[model samples]
Target chain A: MEDLTAVAVHTDVSLWGLFWQAGFIVKLVMVGLLGASIWTWGIILDKSLGFGRAKRAFDRFEQVFWSGQSLEELYRNLGDKRTTGMGAIFIAAMREWKKSFEKGARSPIALQMRIDKAMDVALARESDYLAARLTSLATIGSAGPFIGLFGTVIGIMTSFMGIAGSKSTSLAVVAPGIAEALLATAIGLVAAIPAVIAYNKLSSDAGKLTARMEGFADEFSAILSRQIDEKLPRT
Target chain B: MRGSITSSAIIHAALLGWGLLSFSAPTPMDMANSESMPIDIVSDVSQLQKGDKKAEKNEKPAPKPTQKPQTIPDAQNVGDSETDVETKPATETKAKPVEAAEAPKPSETPVAKPDPQPEPKPEVKPEPKPTPVPATEVKPEPEPKQEVKPDPVAEAINDVKPVPAPAETPKAEPAPQAEKPAEEEFKLPEKVAMPQAKPTPPAQTAKTPDRKETPEKPKTQTASTPSKEKDGIADQVADLLNKQKASAGGAKRSTDQASLGASKTTGGSSLSQSEMDALRGIIEGNWNKPVGAEESPDMKIIVRFRLTQDGQIDGSPEVSGTGADAGLLNAVKSSALRAVMRSAPFNLPQDKYDTWSTVELTFYPGAT
Candidate 1:
């Protein structure tokens, strides 16, 4: 920053200086790019943190389920509060299985079908949560450079107009405008690159998390079906 | 969502601060001017200054030594002859400074005659006597003094109090050329029959300061008649003469304009063409070109003026125009001058103060 300011002192070519001097259209492009970059980074952080939390929750929920605790007791432990991830799938299947007993239902086939349907709906909801905003990341990553190019085009066009008005094709006249223009493209790329990389990494993490939830749902449903057969003896 | 936004803001601030701390903008180092040939206008202008200087020098030596072909064998035996040396070279060289080699022989004798006018003019012309600057200043300081342009230069030299007893007589000649044989008008004719024994004028600078001040008018009128427009500086020399006519003594104006041309020879560089044209346009907007005033003496006027940091005129500017002897040309010169004057305190870029602090503007009045 010391050197940055030193250069500015000698010649006013600082970033802020460029922004201030830029034409209205270029300024608009720069501001828009800035917003996109911030939004991209926000999405990246959210998805990364959310995926990590989901994985940790799934691990804890699986450990509790396999700890030989009674299903009813575990379901009670969920306290009827809104559950998440693998736990939501477990709660949904358990409630369905409990409802069969309360209604004095006799057909194991119908009760089993209802429990599986409940788990499937919960799984789909979790999947939707994991996949949210991923499309926006893809859009920004693909479109960032083109937005930057638009700013550059506007900047260069304005610089040419300056040249015509000045009546001299000297490099000094054109350089500042071009530099200001290029900064827009540079910002666009800066915003885009991280968004693209984060999107790839987080999407993979989310998929792994979903796969774990699906596996847990299958194992819990299998346990319930086995318990039902033993309790009634299928007689 | 809130957490992510806060995280993004923190990350961005950190990134920007770090980038700012580490990044440095690269500055351009000094570079060469791309292939256009650079003109050393000072040398070019000075080289052209020699012709007008020649005609001016011829008049100074004529009033004294009114001898014509007298058989004074004794004076002939005295190999130290002022006439035999100063006259031939004055006419022979025209304006070529090559004969500056012979300029040394008369250094002692020409010292007195050359002292009055050319002395102040050199300091004033910003090296006005381009009569081989090195040779003239080196051989006889007075040789450069020999080119004192305006007749008022004679009075200014008399004012500087260095060389004059007979220099004053030459000063006297300018004011009443009739009283002194109209030497300026007939200076060419006189140069042919010239006996150059004018050493008597150098000693009287102290005696007739009053007599010299009295004679300035006619001398300026006569000075205007003989001035030849050579290069851009020629107009300045004429302007210096005319300025002398206005000021009663051209000496003060010359010294004020010279100021060592210090501002220019420093880190100052020429303004880009656009800058030059803009400056010219601003001045030209105020300039009213004379009708049919489109020739060498009238078409061009150059004014070299100093500017303060705030872009106000620093002092009275030095102005020169060609063929100032004619009334129309004189009007053209003054009108061009009035344009520069009327356009007060110029608006130049501030960051380029070093380059524009002192500007020498060559104005083409009738050009597109």
Candidate 2:
């Protein structure tokens, strides 16, 4: 918000004296635009942190859970805390596989299918989390120029009218006003560009993490399937 | 002896006096000539009738000789008077000749003497009338009457030639003679020459005053001419106003005729043509002609100003309109007031002091 405020002040002033001297109304408009942009930026930061934490946690959980710890021990240590990380997905899949064996419906294919389903659900949930602030960011990205352009259009209209009313032809007469008018658009883009770039990067990163979770689920299924095949009667 | 010489001297003096008196009136000059001719007649008659009739001649010569005896006492009395005393002698001389020639001619002398001699010959008649022999000639007074006009006619012919007639007759005659010269005399050269000299002063004034007064008259005339031109400022301002209006483009919806002065207004206003042109120029120079400004035709700005007594701006402008820019509004309001103040005393119509005292300028960019 502060940076946005600074940008606003800098842009408004450096643009033209008129923008600098803009009235309370214009200041309100600028403040509103900046406020919106700052809000969107905050959402972006929050979503980025949340998504990064989830991806990092997923990776850490994958590494530790697959480090050859005993399955029963891993389950015992998952105590009370919602172990709804990638590690939790592995536990859920294993529990489902054992229940299916006890039900006499156990097969390598059925067990792998249960693990993939649980992993798919986990990946879908993580993907939803990762994509949280993106919609707002997309909105900010697409709508910013239009908002800025609205202010610019207003400012230009006002400047031209002033010229006509004053009957002035000097560039000095028109430039400041026009510059003030365009400031809103510039600020809009300032908010929008970063949002667009961050959103794209976060979305692509979320896709990669989802793909890794799927691959992990596939490998976990394969190991479980081999273990189940070794224990089965040579049928 | 003294009496005879006196008689002879009186006879010569009388002849000369009658000659002068005869010519005094026109009638008497012929009468005197007749007397002289009669004297010549007697001498001829003395030679003819006397030589032929000796008794008649003796009688004529006897009366002539006795005429002298009777004329002798009268001649003494004639010599006492001066101007006419000399005419008495001529009567005596004519009387003597009358008796010397023939009795008939001698008898006719007294008749001619009464008519002619009363005016001219009377100066000589007193001398001759005293004789008893001429008393009978005086009784035949009809002959004097018959000889009156001839005497004057003959004397007039002899004494004054007709050459002097035209000159003195026209002078003496009252008909046209005196009248002609009076008119000529009325046209006195001096009276005419006096007015001719009098015209010079006015002519001199006409030339000299026009030149000398030119500089002076223009000073007074120009002082008034400018104000009058100032009053006419609006008409002069019309063209510049149009330029200002056009520069406003569609910004101004409409224009109105703002009369500078309504009552007793001058032809010129505070905004002279030149000043308005200057203002228009300023506006044109500054304005870019707003595009789509006319989209809203109802938009307008009415700025009102209050000027101090000294023509300085007294208050902030009150503005009302959609398109009014606060800065522009402020500047224009202030500038208008400053212009009014700078123009000091606002060259407004003096008579409309109340109306223009605090002006409200209505500028509508989108009037129409």
Candidate 3:
């Protein structure tokens, strides 16, 4: 009990005390920044995981797509989720090519033009799908530092004002304030670094996947056109 | 939308984790500040003495000579009644030879006069009849002594002399009158005329002794004031003052001497005021000034600590206005500790055990 009281008494007059008892406003600002940081990191991890899975899925889809399997078979294998995404784009353009050529008015060039337009629209749709929530991730990445900075500014301002009030110049007298300020900055960096890394990774993944989908759409349309030309009279 | 949901969750998680970590770790500054103690007590005693001396000397003019010319026997009475008074005239009438001989009287009265005299030896030169000149001269002698009370040997000498002279003079006067021949006593009714002069000398001496003793009395009154005399309570004050001044001078000299060494130790508590202020500015400037590597001001944190009996800190240190890096702060705390340790068993005057146990230090960076 004596030791505890001694320690408490020691702490009461210390810089640590000043920090613990920092104004309500300062603590609130720090708490708010912390919440923001936690939210940003959660977003970063979620995006990283989701984008990783999508990249893996997209890679697997491409392997099956390159195999000597029928387009209908690939479409059936994709099921619901894949069908509505990048794979759906390939299926849509192929289906369009088959329908256009099956009609009696079948010029290869005319059918190809029709398939190209269909593929362009499908590519647009796939890109739009990938683009969801990217803006929020970007916001988190860019804004993390400033949010942390806001906490730091508040902490520093409070610390210095405390120093002024105490009218002291010793490290012990002033340490808590400085530590709190640095803590805000450190927390800010911690929140921001991963957010930034995660955003960059996701963005690049989206770009790669979008490029591959566009290529697949064009190739699949060509494949469907070849199948239609073969079925028709040799010209 | 699915990716968006996941990404938002990730960002929030990261932000939340950091926030929680920050919240959990409450800085220990308050504890540290409370534990901090005063660093150097010896310096405070020396500093206060300097201030007191400076304040006293700055106000008062330099003390004049404290020894007046000794009183003289009446050559006029000898002339009126003594047959030998005629013999002394030829010596006096030798064209004011006595005044030139008495030219060195002021300097010698203060310096070499060991024996106490009955007659005012310097006053006997009746040729000039300059009684007022001697009186003014004697007052200057006592004034110099009041100034010297801050300096003991000189003050004691002044105190011892004047005190006895005033008391003895009156007793001696009546004896001188009774001892004189009847004819000369008749001619010199002057002794009866100024009967008050004898007792008045002792009274004048007693009043002047207190004036001379004021500087010494204050020292004993306030234990912190410096030296208190054993038998010489008055002398002790002057001795303490001188010792304080000497030690202060010695501290300055030793610090200068220490600065002569290579790689002068910085981050110590003994930095001068301007140096500490300048160091604070440096720390403030360096704080967050660097672009990438999260910079804080390089503070020269001087925690002026008073050491405990067991070598722990006695009291909470006083913190400076500026902030410092973690490494710098630790360095300063340890350096201040080392300084305290180096000055172990501090030479506090035994009487001032409580007061000299603690003092303050303001840290300065690069302040050798």
Candidate 4:
């Protein structure tokens, strides 16, 4: 009876014990699942913060772009400096307009087309930048559970082998192994659930931001086209 | 991006710290009770000593009283009759000559005479002889009787020479009076003869061909009835001893086996090897591999199921595997399923529900 109690004491079922005593395969599974979970959290954090910053930058750029400031003054304020998201698109439009003026193009239709083309290219680049690393989030979200399940399967297989080797069915003999196995699945879900949720939310947010930028570019081009039409008859 | 990386690192570190803290805390009450091996050994030894002392106290007194009725008559008449005559002047003088002249013939005839007589008569006569011996001397008789009986038997069985010496003494002391029928009333019956026969046969066999002939020669001697009774008693003694030794040896061996089983149980662990063996043994015991199934050592069926705390299956087990003939697979599946069902309500520790609540057993018949 004393020996029995001693055995019970020695076989501590703590989480650390479970991980420490787990077979090599099970330990490997746990480590992989943990890495995946941590990586998923990192992606989630980065995307959420990046999206918030982009929204603020877009708002600030829109205010300045529509502030009734002179076009050359706004262009010079932006200069050739690599600007924020919305500013980049505004700069691209202004550069094309200045080039058209320098070439002595008197046709407003040709001038408007070149300005729109430049802004469209700049808007595409900004959208691409906003959507960066979002695919990895999607991959992590989708693959997280499967990877966790893989770890669980391997851990359970190792546990069963331990049961077979010891020729024991006692819970003490198998509990630690099974607990370790389940931890893998738990970690997998931990990684996957937030990644999946954040992917859905951030991807949609990025889409909305892209549409807003495109809207800003369209309105800016319309404003430029209207000013050109107003001056064309006078010239 | 740098801020997000920093924040994520902080969160990861916090989770890791929480895990470490939980691990570093002392385990719950269930696991804290383990003692060292010396403590266990000390307790076990104390328990064993207590048991041994109790057994000695009980066993020492038991055989003494049971043995007295068997050894008393011969011991008293053969060894104490003369002493009784010398010590007690009144009753001894009155009973002495009659007892002395009567004792030899009766002792001589008891073996041969008793069996032919009704069995009931021999049993009644031995009880009276012990009642007549002075109480003081008879008290010491049992200890010596115990000491003497085994030595002669062990010597007879071992050396083969001491057999004749012991047998000759009894026959020679009563030889002249062996032919007399004057003491028929005082004759010892087959009851006394049967008990005496138990200890003497191994020695009797080594004495003479006459002893062998005595069993066969009893019928011829019966024509001279007195001698016939003598020969028959010798034959019964030899027969009884052989029978007793065979049975005694058998009893000893079975007791040895029982002690072996007790030792196996004594060393049992808390969640004992026997308990685990019982869990698996019950499941494996119920498994019946299908006849004509393809034999593969690696053939396995993995079964997963949840169990309630009391060990009842919470749901049907999920059986998965597909590597054998259809008939074989079905057989293996059903057999494994039956084993799982039959061995349920398992005797497991209720405290450790986290371990057994979900179980996945992989059955590999070839491994067993």
Model 4 lDDT per residue over B1-368, tens place = 66765677789779877986676545556755343111000011111211232233332112111112232222223233453222334445444545455446646566555565544344324443542321222333333333344453464443343434445446544322322211232332222243342333222322222222222233334445756565566556544432221112211121211121222222222334454556666777776766643365546677777888788988898887566767777788888888889888887765444445676767765443
lDDT of 2 by residue, B301-363 (tens): 454556554544456646554455565545444544343334444333343333344555444
Q: DockQ of candidates 1 onward, in order?
A: 0.36, 0.00, 0.10, 0.23
Under CAPRI classification, how is model 2 graded? Answer: incorrect
The residue-level lDDT of candidate 2 at A57 comes to 82
Candidate 4 error regions (>4 Å): A1-11, A232-235, B23-368
lDDT of 2 by residue, A1-235 (tens): 7744654555333433344555455556666667656666566566566667777888777777778987667766774457654666677676776677788764566666776787677667756765666787788888877787877887777778889999988987887777677777777787688778877887787777667777777777777778778876665
Summarize candidate 3's per-residue lDDT along B90-175 as a digit string, tens digits. Answer: 44344233333343443454343333221223223331142223333343344444445445555446535553544556566453
Q: lDDT per residue, candidate 3, A72-122, as tens digits?
A: 776666645446446777777766755765566457777777878888888
Which has the higher TM-score value, candidate number 2 or candidate number 4? 4
Per-residue lDDT tens digits of candidate 1, residues A1-235? 9854655455455666677678898999999988888889999888888888888888888788889999899999995777889888888898898888888768777777898999999999998899899889988898999999999999999999999999989999999899999999999899889878878887888788889888888888888888877775465
TM-score of 1: 0.45
Compared with the true structure, the alpha-carbon lDDT of candidate 3 equals: 0.51
Positional deviation of B137 in candidate 3, in angstroms? Answer: 48
- Residue B318's lDDT within candidate 1 is 82
Model 2 chain A poorest ten-residue lDDT run? A10-19
lDDT for residue A32 in candidate 3, whole number 0-100? 62
**Where in model 3 is the C-alpha error above 4 Å?**
A1-29, A76-85, A98-107, A166-173, A231-235, B1-368
- Give model 1's DockQ, 2 decimals: 0.36
Show the lowest summed lDDT stretch of 10 residues, model 3 chain B. Answer: B253-262
- Say what the RMSD of model 2 is: 57.6
Evaluated at residue A26, the lDDT of candidate 3 is 58
Candidate 4: C-alpha lDDT: 0.61
